[model samples]
Target: MEKVIILTGASRGIGRAAALMLAKENIVVMASRDINALIELKKEIGASGGKSEALPCDVAKENEVKKMIEDTIQKFGRIDVLINNAGFGIFKRADKFSLEEVENLFRVNLFGVFLCVKYTAPYMIEKKNGQIINISSVAGLNGFKGGSAYSATKFALNGYSESLREDLKEFGIAVSLVCPGGVNTGFGGAVADGKISRDFLLEPEDVARTIKYLVDESETANAKMIELKPRRRKEFR
Candidate 1:
């Protein structure tokens, strides 16, 4: 049977790249808030002789996430992989940013992943085999001056992924976290606009390829966490 993958944030950037790449092998179920972009991706995958289905969902909304998972199971029977690539970072010094903005960042970056896992894990446990890949960030490992809120969310994700790995290992459900340093996606653009250099950053396809590798490998090769950083770049203090 062909493996089924549910990829969040499939409307654009790394999520879109992962959906396209994974669809070449597994059945990709794309979920994101942008219905139009999902339609376009459905066409792209179909044209490339791959299986894909798009579902509109805002990952932060529990009801929407629940519905998306239900629809995916109905369409695909079972899901073998879940790529939680649905997150964004908003940079600002802690004092300079409002509390509401920080909450919004957390809602999407951290809480949404929690909701996805909450809704998807039962299905995976029933099958007794699956993979969960959470796309965190380098900021998650260590904080930067202007990344207070965003960094906090990612840090939460890191811990969450680790705890999940421990809890789900017995169920044959592997959990992994990708902590990339500088990907040339909307993140890079955000940092660039904030006056940080983004030269020679890793592209979205680079990260997507790593994700594809993780999902395609056998259960024995359980990769817990992986980090990717740009070459010859200054480290954030």
Candidate 2:
């Protein structure tokens, strides 16, 4: 079947990698806030003989999120997958989080996932099949200090993805949560920390390949949640 996917956070990082990898076989709707970067990525995909279109949209806003899904449907006729990869984080002590920080983190990480799924789910249902992949984190599995806000969002995402998986199980729409450890995306609102080593970090392509593998599963198989970690610890030395 010809696949069409709406992938958020495609301006860079994991989203960008997934878009490039999946577009080789699927029609990709690249949605992100960085217009220039997305346009460039779209061109790169085109040059590679892959199909993709760039949409500059912020997942944090409901109106924009809705419009993004609508635009994808209008263009592609059906959305076969929704990859909720858009996210950010600010590391700090739990007590140090400002109200704005909490709201902002939730706005993009939790609420964004909800809104994207809300708007895109029905079309998947109508087709009687689809995939929703939520990019979570190991921090969500085990909380740590200075990760209060960031961990909360991913934890909530895991919870929601779990329930949504069962809710739509009968409808042929699969929801999957992927919790990866220590990706080298310069994510979490900071560049790769100097104290951190790449030995324990996953590359963006590794996670991208995971997303593709999950999306490619047959109807008889469902990988509900997957966790990817580096083969060796960075601090082993």
lDDT for each of the candidates?
0.88, 0.88
The alpha-carbon lDDT assigned to residue 212 of candidate 2 equals: 96
In the order shown, the candidates' Cα RMSDs to the true structure are: 1.5, 1.8
What digit string (tens of lDDT, one per residue) describes model 1 on residues 127-159?
999999999988899988788888999999999
Candidate 2 lDDT, 47-82, residue by residue in tens: 999999999889999999999899998887999999
List the candidates' TM-scores in order: 0.96, 0.95
In angstroms, the error of model 1 at 95 is 0.6
Q: In model 2, what lDDT does residue 72 have? A: 92
lDDT of 1 at 44: 91
- Superposed by TM-score, candidate 2 places the C-alpha of residue 178 at a distance from the truth, in angstroms, of 0.7
